[model samples]
Target: MVVSSVEKPIAKQPHASRLYRELAPAYEAVWPILARKRIRAAIGNLELDAGHRLLEVGVGTGMSLDSYPQSIDITGVDLSTEMLAQAQRLVEEERWSNVRLLPMNAEELLFDDSSFDVVTSFHVISVVSDPRRMMREVVRVCKPGGKILIVNHFRSNNSWIARMVDSAGAVTRRLGWRTDLNLHEITADFPLRVERCYKTSPTSLFTILTATKLDA
Candidate 1:
């Protein structure tokens, strides 16, 4: 899974860049309200230690900064510089000296193998064109036995409910989300063992799964 600096650009279209930039401002205002309960529940489930080296993909506005223990070393990456600027502002104001934010795509992470003890992404899978590639990159940088935490929403499994999700997905897709993603299918492709899996909400709109990288 070693990648080089000469790797091809991860974002294939200019529209994707423009799309995120456009949503960055709206996201800051709306995401906290829409996702607060789910985020709090998910963060409560994370099992992190003081010395963990954590990498958070798509750290928009740094909403989850307070979830990490003060003693842990945290590195956050996002595709939007505008969003990262907000995250930086929050991190600086909170006096989180050990945390750093960088602008990077989840599909092509610029890090050495096994560099992190915990890798996480919150509500980002549906927006990425290649979520499988992003998961692979997350696993690539995570050490053997390290943790990978995901909190996201996908189409419900219940046929009746799934139909409703599909309908809503149609509208949301135009705003950069594939709401019909089969998360179970995506998780199967990764080299990780499930440590915990649970639903955060009854409607199946939100889920939290924590897993560990298998030894090579």
Candidate 2:
């Protein structure tokens, strides 16, 4: 069973899947190359070992799936069934015995508390209707002291750059992504010990955040 059950919150936003379904082919073509280096570096920072349980939220097309250590167990979830279908095909082609792909909502993760040793999401925070809620759920499912990785484009701290980017917000929003998401705004309230939050390069548009969920 490549696809698993997901809850109804996703149904409230049917367009989410529609937009991605149409974009699936292009998404698989483009995102992997653009995100590979930063994602690989971020995963390297996780220091994963055999037997670790990892949950990747918004596992779109499984672009970053092969970068993870095969020894560890991986469960990848995505709201877009079209994307998940591509991911399932990849899992099969590679014969990844340790990976499971499921159709799931990021904001409504159906998992037990502390179910995974690590949780990671890429370029997905802003795509959701409520990024903070998605984050709360991200931290919720991760084991205490477990690592959490988020790699996404957030409003730049540079004033001029932020305003310049804001000009494109209208266009991006119409296409289903908001350009004005702020990193600190979404993550500040969580019980996470932020280890590092930095841009991959001086010119990189995305930020890489590495944090550990605080113990209850």
Candidate 3:
């Protein structure tokens, strides 16, 4: 049940890549408290084993690299050259021979269909210009029965909070992501089967979602 890309109008997120470029150097320092543990938790939830080929979209600074087992093969992609530079440095510093970093768009992946055993992204869905398109690409490249994982903050179900977030869109755009993205809307049309969805972090502001690609 592979989903095919369709022509549709996707609202442009013009500042997203530049925002990450500007924040690349200070990103880890600024969000360490909120990000570190949650990232480890997301990677842990993947339950990757040796020889697995993992593709990480939006691999900013490669902060989650160290958490993965050394035996797994990893290819991480990001739109920001600066962020990929930081990730490259980390890969070298850690001498992670199993890892590779590239600058690419998640919405338009370059890989062949069913190329990887696992595909994951962290805090990235909200930042991409077209979350649904990016997700379709994720599913398209993942092998049948492969796992897909995503961790990010979604639009609150509470009406008041959701309205407030939606109203603050202009302000949040400068920060490189939307504050009111609907998780269900993003995943609704995809062919994958949802495995689980749960909130994480101290404030429970973010969610860890896991799904498996249906076997063809």
183 Cα displacement, candidate 2 (Å): 1.1
Relative to the true structure, how large is the alpha-carbon lDDT of every model? 0.82, 0.87, 0.84
lDDT, model 3, position 59: 94
Which residue pairs in candidate 1 collide? none
TM-score between model 1 and native = 0.91
> Per-residue alpha-carbon lDDT of model 1 for 1-216, expressed as tens digits?
224552344555434455877777887888898876776777677787888899999888898888778989999988877788889999989999999887788888889989999998988887888888888888999999999988887667788888978878767888787878887767886788998878865655787888999987
TM-score, predicted candidate 2 vs. hidden true structure: 0.94
Using TM-score as the measure, name the better of candidate 2 and candidate 3: 2
- Stretches of model 1 off by over 4 angstroms after superposition: 1-16
Query: Once superposed on the true structure, which residue ranges of model 2 sit more than 4 Å away at CA?
Result: 1-10
Measured by TM-score, the strongest candidate is 2
| RMSD list, candidates in order | 2.7, 2.5, 4.9
Q: List clashing residue pairs in candidate 2.
A: none
Estimate the lDDT of model 1.
0.82
Ranking by TM-score: 2, 1, 3
How many pairs of residues collide in each model?
Answer: 0, 0, 0
Please give, for residues 18-103, the per-residue lDDT of candidate 3 as tens digits. Answer: 89888887887887677878878878878788999999999999988888999999999887778989989989998999998877
TM-score of each: 0.91, 0.94, 0.89
